[model samples]
Target: MGRIAAGDGESYARSISTSSNVEIRRRTRVTDIAQRVAKLMWQWAAHIVRRKDGRWGPKVLEWQPRTGKRSVGRPPKRWTDDIKRVAGIR
Candidate 1:
């Protein structure tokens, strides 16, 4: 094992194998690529849904309850106004 300086200027211990380090780096890259692809897929799916019904789809935006506020278990439904505008819905 070896210690390396982290972004926060703290030394963290990690495995000393070169192969392990390479695998970790590869996994990180793969995760980033997956995230990008997922975002693109979501946008395409949302576009298709909106085009089919002239209305925003369920996945376009999600509503979350206000922080530190009491409310029902389900958060209020909301739309992404920005996305709506981009989609020229309204």
Candidate 2:
């Protein structure tokens, strides 16, 4: 930018460099943000798979040494719910 502003025939170079964001979307071209978004959504769905111990974590029942105790109350929003909301799943 400095070099372009200081000399003639350099403004073109500066403008081209600055306008690249609009000309090319890096997320869609390189990494493909849509794919990453889907992967994340599936991970969220996996989070809702219940276990026999009344937990939202591991699928295996009593597979770990962690306590499976529950409180006498309602539960919070499930990941599956959010996943459905975002992906528009009924």
Candidate 2: TM-score?
A: 0.32
What is the alpha-carbon lDDT for the whole of candidate 2? 0.58
Best by TM-score: 2
Clashes of each: 0, 0
Q: After superposition, which runs of candidate 1 have C-alpha atoms over 4 Å from their true positions? A: 1-31, 53-90
What's the TM-score of every candidate structure?
A: 0.26, 0.32
- lDDT scores of the candidates, listed in order: 0.56, 0.58
lDDT of 2 by residue, 1-90 (tens): 245445656767666667655365653465557778878768755555533466635543213334577666875556456567777978
Rate residue 63 of model 1 by lDDT: 46
Candidate 1 per-residue C-alpha lDDT over 1-90 given as tens digits, one digit per residue, 9 for 90 to 100: 244446633323323243574487686665566567757866775666667554555434554446896675965544455446546886
> Which pairs clash (backbone N, Cα, C closer than 3 Å) in model 2?
none
> On a 0 to 100 scale, what is the lDDT of residue 41 in model 2?
68
